[model samples]
Target: MFCASLADVFDNSVDLAWRADLWALVRDTPHLDWLVLTKRIGNVSAMLPADWGCGYGNVWLGISVVSQDEADRDIPKLLCLPAAVRWLSLEPLLGSVSLQSATGPFGETLDWAVVGGESGPHARPMKAEWVHDLRAQCGTLAIAFFFKQWGGHENGK
Candidate 1:
């Protein structure tokens, strides 16, 4: 399950005591693979719990890569951090991104990538070729790819 869905867990505004409580729960729930996505990838090292040796087996870290500039800047940071699974989320995909495709512990570039267009009244449209290109890149590097949506004002079953 995703924690801090509406707020950033890395936000300094959140009390340290509260985060400690959450970490305690995360430690107890070994059966759940906590998928944590953050825009604050830079804050991870300093904020990590003392028990986070190398990385936690149950936690998967994902970072946002909205555009080429961000991908270039953030992907490298993620590469240095150890995790069971390191993924990229190109959601609300703004433009074509040259991920350049790096690798994981076992040589997989990305454990997975989730691609999706923006969704809202003024949602921006995304191109099929963009998705195709990202999928191709992942395929070439042996990374898993998941297409979340074409996206629109309406989201229904």
Candidate 2:
């Protein structure tokens, strides 16, 4: 699995490999049967190739929409990617977000979604309503949803 930042590079820090690295790795060796993308919201402005990482059925690209703000910004980018399977990562759900408000690119390409609350010190809050809305949206769109864990401080209790 590749983290979001690894896929999109900005600010001219040229040490890491490009998105094609994923494609190359997968093409060279399809040993990777499952891949999960993390923190995808961090890459709103970066340029990704049209083929985008890997299109193999075994790979899954997921974007983390931490809040409504991230949902608006990053979801579009993730939707536009050429990956075969696209998904959303709503971990650390801090604020309200609506899949109904999502645009065409998002509503169409998304294949799955995961929802969960924040955890650890200074953990943020998540309303059950928010998760319900996300779940409803996923169901409406026929997308799969996964809820990880609520924040350890509040919801976990």
> Which numbered prediction scores highest in TM-score against the true structure?
1
Candidate 1 to truth, TM = 0.90
- Per-residue lDDT tens digits of candidate 2, residues 35-151? 456553455235343544445666676776788877877777666655667788788788778775444543545788878888777777788878888888888878888888777
TM-score of each: 0.90, 0.73
| Superposed Cα deviation of residue 77, candidate 2 (Å) | 1.9
| Tens digits of lDDT, candidate 1, 1-157 | 7877677777777789887887788889989988888889899877778888867888888897888888888888887787778888898887887668465345545688899988888888787778889999889877789999978733321
Model 1 lDDT, residue 92, Cα: 82
